[model samples]
Target: MIRAAAKNHKDVLVVVDSQDYPRLLEFLQGNQDDQEFRMMLAWKAFQHSGLYDCAVSEWLWKQPTVGGEYPLSFAVPLSLKSSLRYGENPHQTAAVYVDKRLSEVNAGGIASAIQHHGKEMSFNNYLDADAAWNCVRDFNNPTCVIVKHTNPCGVASRDDIIEAYRLAVKADPVSAFLGYTASTIVDPVGGVGGIWLIWDPTQVSVSAHIANSQLIQATVKRENFKEWVLAAVYASPNPGIRQNLWNDLENTSSLMVRPWLIAGTILPIS
Candidate 1:
């Protein structure tokens, strides 16, 4: 019937067989001669058949049981919401989706995050943010988490937000450079190397002096000086982490403030 329709120059063909539907569609979609596509179709068919066989076996196994003991079946539905800017790297494509079942029960997952500012997030950002957010969320006290490559390089919990951040950074200052910090408060002081700060901006405030002084006397006294002082701030709903503390110096100059937020959590107020 399909060949007959094609012989007659039909514009489209509708295939109804579950077993051949995917392959037919793939063939019509210009993958007719692709070996990879053929292999993928075969694998998918095998998986589908295997699942059906498993279901039948499960049913048969339950039929012989006297006490009606059977394995429970579970299904999770997911919906794609948007595509990420990129995967771990720029060459890879990525997307974000939400589990319908889980989203109903939990309110704090990545799918619920709100971006206040900044450029589109990458796959690594979501991964790193999730790691940092989960770590800080587990701590009740003011905490700071500096994540480098999906691992926490520095983490500290303290009553003082600034002190917690300092202690976290002090844990592994070198690794903390260009790392992501998740905490309840963050300060945008200079001297501390580049870092991505993520926290709840509503719970933090900038000091008048520290906010005014971008470069302080202590930063100048440092032997190894970097041209750029601080990196970006992300305002999230998670706990806030503090930034570096600026020394009270008469000759300190005010820092240029940039307002940016990493989507989901962590934000810097200008």
Candidate 2:
């Protein structure tokens, strides 16, 4: 029996009641390519981390398979962590965490991602991006979203990915030019010309590029369900930023004032 309750069954795989740390590591190292081996590895990882034992599981429903579907489907478990985003306000702070398993079968291939650049994402960035991407990702076409503060200044869905860019530009060209453009989370490609950013608190100017307008290629609305959200605590204090600061702040929400914005959707005033 594949016991998911790690806290309850911590000793199930234990040899002679020992924690078996080495054995655990060995097991993971071995049979890495085997589908069944991967499943076991996933369970063991969850058990060791206490996610299945101490943490709550999400998206825990069963589904049918293809061709009138057999009852057997994957019970994949995915995890999520909510980090501190400077807070609801720069002064106020908050956090939200979840353990959502995206699948239950074929465990060996799962892995987490690491950010190489940009400012740290905040609670609002997650929420707004979740909402923003959810709206555009299903288009079976490429789309672009310009988010100011946390609200959607521009969201365009079309057959041509460029058209999506044009729509976003048309919605709020001024804000779109300054705001962040997030792709999808599952995107193998890290949106360079158009993507999210991290606000450097020390420097006043946010990191960006002038040629981002040129690299856009393809026109798609097929919706791959990948996306990202972006925001800077504040714009760069550079002369270029200074010119747009008022408009950026006025057009976009204030991280200091408004902790988050759900682009393309209504946000309740706190």
Highest-scoring model, TM-score:
1
Judged by whole-model lDDT over C-alpha atoms, candidate 2 comes out at 0.44
lDDT string, candidate 2, 1-270, tens digits: 334433334333422224556755777577543444344544565555544433332223222332233324333334445455446555556664443433244221212233467656665656666666656656666788777666777887788888888778888856764433443221112111122332323333322311121111111122353232233222222444344534544554432342332221111212
Q: lDDT values of the candidates? A: 0.53, 0.44
Give the lowest summed-lDDT range of ten residues in model 1: 213-222
| TM-score of predicted structure 2 | 0.36
- List model 1 lDDT by residue over 7-57, tens digit each: 333343433347677667667677346545444544544444555566666
Residue 204 lDDT in candidate 2: 32
